[model samples]
Target: MFKYVYSLVFCIILGISPSFSQHTEEHAAATTAGHEEEKFDIGGMIMHHIADEHGWEFTHGVKLPLPIILYTADRGIEVFSSSRLDHGQVYNDYKNEHEHIVRVNADGTVNEAIHPMDFSITKNVATLMLGALLLILIFTSVSKGYVQNKGKAPKGIQSFLEPLIVYMRDEVVKPSIGKNYGKYFPYLLTLFFFIFINNLLGLLPGGANLTGNIAITLVLALITFLITNLSANKYYWKHILLPNTPKWMWVIMIPVEVVGVLMKPLSLMIRLFANITAGHIIMLSLFGLIFIFKSWAVAPAIGVFALFMSAIELLVAFLQAFIFTLLTSMYIGSAIEEHHAEEHH
Candidate 1:
């Protein structure tokens, strides 16, 4: 278990690179070079880390350039390193304007005619891939541990993850998803751990806010929505279309039920995105206070509060993941519920 913990820490430390490298490093470079005595803008700093970008800002001025893949009407498809546009430099008539790659003409003017379809791997996308890789590595080792110690007491990584797996399987998924939980356990488990891992990663210094991004949350919600509706029994639809209410009230109940169906996933997406993003914004804002007041006196107070907030955010990270998985199972359980169960009720 100790060795496994060390491995996890190493992988995370390796992956927690700053996002949107171009802008963040450019500003840092300018500040270091004494080119301009610019006023400290906390909003920009917060956004620089929160938003997606082409290059990986590995550490201060040192960027690990990612590949830029774009498709344009004229160019068909162009592939190159993001370093070409580092520090606001334009290469081959393309510019990275706040991480948006746009075509520029000879006079350095933006070309309106050509709209490039960006297929580049951004910061969040990279983090998602990293998390996926980590998950694969983690479970692979755990599987080995289980096999090596089959029927014996769990040890190492298996011992660490087995409890989490068992807890989710029995306490959360089984109860929320009913008897049909076996089939959906894989998905629910994966979703929970994925979000939980990304949430924890986003809390680290210079970590990309993968889970905080709406695009990522929206995908998770949509998957749940699709699974819930597709597996829904006739009774589930019947309850929506023809509720227990009177025929006269069907008009109100039907539309309301339809909206309710859509709202479930919408609420899931917003809740996770808002909570993760808000936590990040608050943390960054607290750090910004030092620059805001231009005094070292406030550091101790802010540090104490930041420490407290970090603890809260840690709990929230797991809570949000658990809530998402639990709610998804409940929705599935509702959709597949037997008519006999309703009759019993």
Candidate 2:
């Protein structure tokens, strides 16, 4: 994980070199001796791909426009295609800066005073919808196969996914969550497959960074946090609020336990975000190296390294989803666990 993070930082540094090269070009142009040159905007390129935008990038230069919905006190409500903005050219008192739509004044400067509420169907949101639809299609078909096949062997996608699902239920969920885990099995399984599928999709070129987005991870963790505490039995709260510790330690123990509740979700959020984002940044950085070196000779080497990293990321995708689901099961188990009278006594 640390190696992945280090690679990400190194890539960001490499990404900034384009701006440095541009500055050098400007300086050279001012001098007596100068030659024409092109500058690589590595930072911009990486950010453009990583950050959510109002349009889907289909290729290096092509983007499919999405609807732009904005609401302002003065304009009331404006609905139009994102293409109207023309990739930052013009829109209802707004302009695109670094793929971020910001309100602008008549003079074409940022209008800091009037920040319109943007409710655009961004690329990230669209990809989320797509992922959700795919999940529905897959599971729905698998369900029909189960009903129709009825006591027979699985087939088609069901055959492929059955072992993995069974492994998750038996190995990860049942053991960690204990008996009567059936109630939470569906939720855990859905969470695992949803995250795993999204992670894999993110690896595709021009795909949305759905799982890497902090907001998405935050929401996912929040669900686990709520489920853990909400399903907690009297025994669970008793351990935290009225632990086996002496009365004198209550002051420290209670607060510490309360903080621990919050920290679990926070850790979940950061772990998923950092791991997924670091993987992507590292991959992008490897691709950026070819432009940085300006040499075709190094292409094969970089491609091999990037390909190797991608394989690792593929494993990470499944690993992270499984870890997250397993931890969630453990938390749930701890909450709903029945404490024997002998143990408490």
Q: Candidates' lDDT values, in order?
A: 0.81, 0.77
| Residue lDDT tens for model 1, 1-345 | 112211133234433322323233323435565676456778888887788789877546777788999998777989999999998899989999999999999999999998899999877888889888887888778778977998999997777777788888899888887898888888888888888888878877657788889999999999999999999999999999999888999999999999999999999999999999998888878877887787879999998998888778877878999899999999999999889655556
Candidate 1: segments with Cα more than 4 A from true spot = 1-37, 340-345
Candidate 2 residue-wise lDDT, 196-302, digit = tens? 87787777766788899999999999999999999999999999999888999999999999999899989988999899888877877777777778777898998
- Maximum-TM-score candidate: 1
In model 2, the clashing pairs are none
Give stretches of model 2 more than 4 Å off: 1-34
The TM-score, computed over Cα atoms with residue i paired to residue i, of candidate 2 is 0.88
